[model samples]
Target: MSRIVSLTASVFAIGLFAGSAVAAGDTITIGIPVGLSGANSVVAPSVVQASELAVDEINAKGGILGKKVVLEVADDASGAAGAQKAYDLLIFKKKVDAIVAMETSAARNAGLPIVNRGKIPYIYTSFYEGRSCNPYMYINAWVPEQQVAPIVDYFNKQGAKTFFLIGSDYAFGRGMLAFTKEYIEKNGGKVVGDEYAPMDATDWTAVLAKVKAVNPDAIITSTAGGAPNVTLTKQLRAAGIKALYGNLAVDEGTARSMGADAEGIYIAGSYFTNIDTPANKSFLAAVEKKFGNDLKTPNELSVPQYEAILAYKAAVEKAGTTEAAKVVPALAEVSVEGPRGTIAMSKQRHAPLTMYLGQVKADGSVSIISSFKDVDPGEQCPKLK
Candidate 1:
């Protein structure tokens, strides 16, 4: 944590992101508040890379609304307490016009009220537990409807009648699995055991013991995104639990980093490197060229960060101003086609996402198994209008 803090201070001091917005003196500042330490640390680099690529591209072609754009980044350290500090530094101190972030659900929840008070356009770029609504906020990531259904439905088809559930015991972990449990029960599947550990719990021996005893046909986990995902998956493999494994929260980059431990496990997502679309190809090339060896693998968690920044730009263009009230509504009215396909958020304050069911290979690559297009985020703040 200290080393990360030092690195952040050095970047800011060196004027790394001080762009033409400085010389122009007329700029729209967009703050990126993401986790640089703790559970989200493993996935935050991908978000940072995607954000840098999108911002550089946007700035290259004139800036947003004829004003140069500047990005101010602060690390939330992956929890509620850290989020408050990150939000305060960006919102009150820097006075950014907008925020584009892919943060943990706890961090998002903690920072949202501050963003509202500051009255900036906030674009949340994480696939989360859902149902978070604010007048000035919009989300471009998957919810339970888009992400969980494919996994449950596919497992059911594979004759996975009995299952066990495990999670990080947080809002995202419990919330997603709650929906999974309901979905399983509704689909006539049975759950033998359901367990949750703390968000930061690294040791899963006891959890595996409980999981192993059930002997269910399948096991699904929803740990906190980065470190917990790695820890639990590694331990699950080491313990040789062997029931069919599925993850609701692991991103492609983390999955790949797990090596053999992640092989044969299943996940549902919105984007992958092998998307084979012109937009995705172009985006990937730009990121690779810009960051080169430092680039983290782009995945569902980070792709939406890039898209959200673009979508925010579109909303500002559509609204003809950066005022939160106007841009907020315009956000739902606009669309951005990026690596994940075209994303058109709804008046309900959520997007209709395209979902993919993928299985991780021995080398950490995910192979697509099935796809569902334009899945609606059901009833997420329907009264937002």
Candidate 2:
């Protein structure tokens, strides 16, 4: 962790020095408060790398308003309190121009006090249970309506009306199930069972045994690496729970880690490895070139971190200033040509997002089963008005 912070510090210091030495007139610091340690670190490195890549690409293209972009990353260590402290340090000490965050909605929610008080632009880069409308915060990933709503419709179409809800017992999980439950009931489906596991629990046999006993026609889970999606699948399969298993948690990296055990699982997200777009192809090739075959792009879950940086760059350029008031409006109008597609932010909602549903192939690869033909930010946050 220290090595990572040192590397980030060094790179950012270089950017700062380069800003002064080169024609670049200023330096804009973007703070990242994310799970940089613990189990969630599997995705943190990629998030940092993606943000760095965006900064590099922008700097190479003359940067934002002749100012070099610098990243200030602090370890959240997968805890809400730790994430809040990281955000405070980055804001009070580093004095960053904007903030980008990862998973752990609790962390983001906790940091809202600082962000609202400071009134600096903030972008969240995780597919989450969204309903926040902070003028200063632009959520740059899929929300419940975009990620989970369609899955309910899909399952209903398949005649899988009964469901069992499972997830980590946290803001992200609880919020997701809240929306999922509403959708299931609205769609005429019944939820036969529900369960919650701690964010870092390793044993889920008890939960799986209960799920098997309930034996719903389908199961939906919202979880992350701490309580990996595979652990549930493994225990469920062993428990002889043959119901259709689906999750919003199984991204390409998770699927790869789960190996054959992940096959036949259904997943709903905002991005997929099999997206046939020039943007995605080029992005994947670049990631492969940089990280080698061992690392996967982690689906659209990882794309928001990359896109948020680019969006920040574009906002700075469009606003012609780094002031939050100027940048916030510019951000709502900025459309990023992300790997998934063009992601446009809506002024009504402080979020820019899209949606994609895919099924894990027998080989652990994903096949896009359905997609919103055009990326939409969904219903804008009414409160933003």
Write one digit per residue (lDDT tens) for candidate 1, span 242-346.
788889999988888888999998999999887778988988888878766556788888899999999999999999998887898898889998988898887
Off by over 4 Å in 1: 1-16, 19-25
Best by TM-score: 1
Give the alpha-carbon lDDT of every model.
0.86, 0.74
Relative to the true structure, candidate 1 reaches a TM of 0.95
* Position 182, candidate 1: lDDT: 94
Clashes of 2: 0
TM-score of each predicted structure versus truth: 0.95, 0.89
**Per-residue lDDT for 215 in model 2?**
77
Candidate 2 has what TM-score? 0.89
